[model samples]
Target: MDWLLKATTPAEKILVMFVAILLFAGVMAFILYVSEKLPRWIPAVGFLLPAVIMLAFGLLWPGLRTIFDSFRDAAGRKSVGVDNYVTVLTNPDFQIILLNTLAWVVAVPLLSTVFGLLYAVLVDRTRFEKLAKTLIFLPMAISMVGASIIWKFVYQYKPATANQTGFANQILVWLGLPPQQFLLNPPWNTGFLIVIMIWIQTGFAMTILSASIKAIPDEITEAAQIDGAGSLSTFFNITVPSIRPALIVVITTIAMATLKIFDIVRTATGGQFQTSVIANEFYSQKFSQGNNGIAATLAVILFVLVIPIVIYNVRQMRISEGER
Candidate 1:
């Protein structure tokens, strides 16, 4: 127990991990084997028991504890009722965070979907389609942290006297304009960070929407064209309507991703300059400010925000399945 409790060497850690996995698997197999001799319901119960227990401890218990802690004080020693929630909801700084989060949530999914849909439609069967898609999709391969760092260099700033290395500022320099600090500017810096999210997520939207576009029956498109429909008209009336379900999925998925955006904000701006979103604010309150109560409150807020999107997604998926 002490060995398991304390940190160990890498080799020892690996051995322990392997042994634990093996033991768990053996226990499960033994349970199943024994259950086979009992009623059929026993095996069903055995199969579900481990997952139920894991979820109880891993997800349900932690969530309940966090909610409970949200009502406690910063130090977790005193109960404060809804004070933390009230402070978070009413604070001017956190208001900006909420506004920035709203902007990100609205902007990223809309722009990403628009760009992805247009690009997918344009390149669906064209020459060099694969190359074009691969180039756009390349950003999706990079982690959010990696993308943020790469774009941070792109948005990096220097005085007008020095040579600008940032691609954005360098272009400005070439245009005889002063170099600007993209991440240090308030109110608009959040927009810049949202662009990074849009860039990364566009590829995902494209891949999903592209597949959906391809799945649209050729007969419908042909009929639309034969009916004297132009490209734009055909796209709006036929293609858009045909892929409405996929569009919903893309929008909701991207919205969920945008709601939890943290890595890019942290990597690029460190949540300074009014660029903080809810997720980054959560980290700041919990670790930087040591406001456990407020941190838990923010966590609960995020969870609450996500619930509706998830439910809507599930409902949409079911409706789509029924339509099919």
Candidate 2:
């Protein structure tokens, strides 16, 4: 505290701190009044008002500003029309980022949902069901940064002839293969990161899918058995088709999460070795490089990318609702 007072320029520090304290106090009071004292409707309004105001201030305004800026030059001083958009689509590195985005959107969700559904089905009625589910679901409770740190060690690397100590590399060396840099290679490293996402998301998918699996009428499974359908056939024909809607929900949700996978890439590689994706690129362009227009364009592209998956999720949810 003394360091802050001493280091800070008096004029800037006092004024800035004064404003910060005022804002903090105002926000705290607003929260308490809404959360504790406000009438139900007023509280609902109070809770939502800040979010709406925040959306207006933080998201909506900036989105509109970005769209405007995308039309302007680097200085944000003159209109460049569609040139920035055109350049983004054509730029090679951005193109890789776009492709990387596509790969994430495609791979993580499908694998996670599939593995989740399979595991959910396998353990749904088993004796050790709770334990199995808990083990797999543990990663979902971990923060992304924490998960990234854990996997970073698992994918740890050392140069050739050095002792292979990374979890994966050690396994390889046990089999007499050379130590390898799992997170440093191009294209494949992207897949390695996708594995981390899948590892984390599979539990979510499994929990949702396990419920849907249980919700399958016991009569249906018994009838399938009486009809001479073996376990595998019943799972394929009845369980899968019956749970298709839930699967769709899992896939879509995971897909949306995958598109914004900044933490994994950022923490593991810092977007080096051609592993950059749209989310990391946006941060670099906007904050690191101070290219707000390009950042906005990237955000807009991501928004466009997410809308369809969201729509599909909504439609699947509706279908699930109708089925009920």
Name the candidate that leads on lDDT.
Answer: 1
Which run of 10 residues does model 2 get worst, by summed lDDT? 1-10
- Model 2, 1-324: lDDT tens digits are 554456467777887778779988899797877578755576777667777998899988987887788787766888878887898899998899999989988999989988998898788778999999999999999998999899999989876678766889888888988887888888999989889899999999999999989998999999999999999999999999998998888888889999988998898888998889999998988888888678878888888888999999998889879988
* Candidate with the greatest TM-score versus the true structure: 1
**lDDT of each residue in 14-114, candidate 1, tens digit only:** 87888889999999889889888887576888888889999999999999999999999998999999998889889898899999999999999999999
Q: What lDDT is obtained when candidate 1 is compared to the true structure?
A: 0.93
Q: What is the lDDT of residue 161 in candidate 1?
A: 90
For each candidate, give its TM-score against the true structure. 0.94, 0.86
Worst lDDT run of 10 residues, candidate 1, spans 1-10
After superposition, candidate 2 runs with Cα above 4 Å error:
1-51
